[model samples]
Target: MTGLSPDARAWLEQHGFIPTDDAVWLEALTHGSFNGSGPADAADYQRLEFLGDRVLGLSVAAWLFRAGDAPEGKLSQRLNALVSGTTCARIARSIGLPEHIRLGKQARDDGGADSDKILGDVMEALIGACFIEHGFDTAQGLIYRLWAKELEGDVGKAKHPKSALQEWAAGNRRAPPVYTVTDRSGPDHAARFTVEVSVRNVGNAEATASSKGEAERLAAKAFLERFG
Candidate 1:
C-alpha cells in the first residue's frame, strides 16, 4: 500500500506533530466509501470525525470565551463560522490534505479527494487522532494555529450569510428565507448545484457551487448584497 508522501510527512513535522501510531493516522485519512463491502472497516474516520466535531466545538468555544469579552451571541457566531465544514475544508486544502486522503479507485476518479465533505470529515478525524495521541492541549494548540487568521478577522461578520439573512427577515417581520435547488449538473464527483434563495417581499438570489451548502451560502450572500 502507498504510504504518506514525503511532503505530507514534512507538513506534519512542520506543524509539530509526529504520529506515534501510524495506523491511527492512516485510519483518520480513510473514507467510508473506500470500502464497497457490507460495512466499512472499524478503523475508518467516521468515529474519529464524530469525536473531532465535539473537540473542535469545545476548543473554539473556550478560546473565543477567553480571548475577549465578546458576549455570548458574538462568541457563538464566531464559533459556528470557525468550526464550519467550509472552514475545515479550507484548512485542509491549505495544508495539502487532499493529497493524503485514501479513497477507492472510483472515488478518486470521481474527485472525492477534493470534495469539501470528505476533506472536512478527514480534517476532523485528524484532529481527533491528534487529541488521542498528543492530548487536548496539543490539539487545541493546533486548532488555534490553523484558525488564527479567521479568528483575527471581523468576528461580527463571521456568521454565515444564510443565518444573517434569516435574522434580517425576523427583525423585519418577514417570512423566513426559502431556498430551492434550481439546477444541478455535472458528474457525481464534480457535480454543481445551483440554489436560489427567496426572502419574502425582499428579493431573490442565485448561486452555484460544487456543494449544496456552499451554493446556499453564496445565494444568501448575493441576496443580502442586493437587498439587505
Candidate 2:
C-alpha cells in the first residue's frame, strides 16, 4: 500500500518476481520495530527474513551444484561471500528496495528506512514473500536476475577488500593484519567508529565507518592495499 505501484509491480514481475498477495508484500516491507502492537496490528518481516535466508541458501547451493568443477570448500566459501550481509545489502540497494520499505514514523525519522541491515532484511523478506506467493522456481529466478552480474562473472573470484587483504597477508607470510577501534564518536543511537589496522611488519592504516565492524574491515582493506 505504501510503496507499491503499478510501475513497481510491473518492474518486479518483468524481473521474474510476482507477488500474488499484496498484503504479504506489504508485510515483507514492514520493519519489526514498527510493529509495536504485534502481528495483529502490523505484520513484520522477521518471519519472512527467516524463510528467505533459507531459500537463498538453498538456491545458491543449487546453483553451485549445477555450475560444475568447484570443490565443496570453494563452493561453500563462495556461497558465504555471496550471501553475506554486505552483499545482500548491496543487492537491495541496487533494486531500490529501500525506497519501497514501510517503516514507522520513528524509524523514518531515525533514518532506519535507509539502514543496510533493514534493507537487507527487507530484501530477504521480499524473496520469502515471492517464494510463498509463487514458489522456489519463481524466487530463484528473481534471485538469479538480481545476482546474475555477481554470480556469472568470475563466481569464485575474491573481490571484496577484506578478502583481498587476507589473501595478501597470507601470501606474504606476515601475521594477518590486526584491526582495532581507535576512536568512537556520535550519539548513542548513531555512533561512528574509527579503525586502525596494523600489519605485523607494515605501517598502520586507518579508516572511519558508520559501524566499528565496517570501519575495521575498511581499515584492514586500506592497509592491505597500501602495504600488502
Candidate 3:
C-alpha cells in the first residue's frame, strides 16, 4: 500500500499532530462507501469516530478544568453546547476536513461528502487518528487548536441571552427586555420569523431568521451588542 501523501503528512505536521501509522490516517479518511469498489480491507471511519468522540470530550473537560473558576454546572452546560452536533460540524467545515475524505461513488453522487453527519464523523475520526498516532497531549493540543475560537466565544455567550439580558437589566435596576414578533412569513418547508427586542431602559434591535429560535437568538445577540 502506498504511504500517506507528502501533502497529507505536511497538513498533519502543520497542525502539530504526527501520525506514526500512515495507514490508520488513510483509513480514517476513508468512508465505508468507498471500500466496495477499491481496496477490500480498507476500513471506514466508524470505529475511529467512536474513539474520537471520547477523546474530544476528555480534552474539552480537561480544558474546562484548568481554565475556569466557574461552578461545575455552568462548565457542563457550556461543554454541552460546545460539543453539540452543530458545533462539531462547524469546526469540521472550518478545518476544511471534508475536502480530504475519500468517499464511494454512491456517496459522492448523493453529496455525502458535504453531509453534516459525515463531516462530523470524519472530524471524530481525525481526532481518533491523532490520539492513536501522537498520544493524549498531542490530541488535546490539536482539539484545542481546532476549537479554541469556538470555546472562547461560547464562554462569553454562555448565558442564554434572555436570561443574561434579564440579569443585566435587574443588576442595573432597569426593566427586562421584551421580544415582539414583527413579521412571520414563508412556506411551510422554510418559514421565516422576524423579531424585535426592546429593553426597558435601553434601545431596540431586530433580527430575522428561518426559525423563531434562531430569530430570538439573533435578536438577543443584537440587543447585547447594541445595549449590553
Candidate 4:
C-alpha cells in the first residue's frame, strides 16, 4: 500500500515520523471529513483517535508517575494537563501537523486543519498508528520525545486559572464566579468565543480564546488579575 503522500511524508519525516505501514499512517492522517462524511469510517482517524487518546493518557501518566514522587493528586493533575486536547493541539502545532491532515475540500476550506479538535485528534491518531504498527515501547518513546518540554516545564506548580478564581471568590466571601459567553464567531472547526467573568460586587473582566472553556479560563484569569 502506498504510504503518506509525498509532502506529508516529508513533513512527518522532518518530525521523526517515518512509517513502516504507509497505508495505516495515511489513514491515521485522514480526517472524518476527508470524503464529506456523515461519520468517520475505518478509513478515517476517529477509531484511531480513540485508541490514541488512551495511549497518550497511559504514556503521560506513566511518565509522570515515574518522574515524580509526588502524591497521586499531583500526578493526576500533571497527567490531565499533559494529555488534554489543548496540549495535544499545541504539540501538533509545534510539529507543524496542521498542513499534514488529509481533509475534504469543504473541511479544508472551513479551516478544519487548524481546528483544535481536528489537530488534537490527528495527533492522537498518529500516536495510535505508531502504537499499532510498532509497539507500546515505540509509541511511548515517541511521546516522551514529543512531550519532553511540557514534562519538564512548570505546569505542575501553576494552578489552573479557573480553579484559582473559584477559590479566590470563596475566600473573599463573594458568590461563586459567573462566566457568560458573550459572543461566538467563525467556522465550526475554528470558532472563537468571548467570555465575561464576574465575581458579584468584586469586579468583572473579559477575554477570548479558541474554545469556550479556554475563553472562560482566560476570563477568570483576567478577573483575578484585575480584582484579586
List model 4 lDDT by residue over 71-164, tens digit each.
9878877787888778999999999998888888888888888888889889999999989988888899899999999999875557888989
Tens-place lDDT digits, model 3, residues 1-228: 467778777876666667778888988888888787668888888999999999998888788878878788788877776765557777888866776787877777666666656777788888999889878888888899899898777543467776677787788888777889999875432356899988765789899865576578789888888888
What is the per-residue lDDT of model 2 for residues 1-228, given as tens digits with 9 covering 90 to 100?
344567767756665667667778778878866665334467888999999988988998898889888888788878976776667888888877776676667666777766666777788888899999988998998888898887886644555577678788789887787778889875433356899988777689999866777787788778866876
For each candidate in the order shown, give its overall lDDT on alpha carbons.
Answer: 0.83, 0.77, 0.78, 0.85
Query: Candidate 1 or 3, higher TM-score?
Result: 1
Can you write out model 1's per-residue Cα lDDT over 1-228, one digit (the tens) per residue?
345557766777776667777767777888766666313543679888998888898998998888889878888778877888878998899988897787877788888888887898899998998998989999989888888887777744567798899998999999999999999986665578999999877789999988898899899999989988
lDDT of 4: 0.85
What is the descending TM-score order? 4, 1, 2, 3
Query: Which is the leading candidate under TM-score?
Result: 4
RMSD of each: 3.1, 3.5, 6.6, 2.5
Candidate 2's displacement at residue 183, Å, is: 4.7
Q: Which residue pairs of candidate 4 clash?
A: none
* Superposed Cα deviation of residue 190, candidate 1 (Å): 6.0
TM-score of 2: 0.80
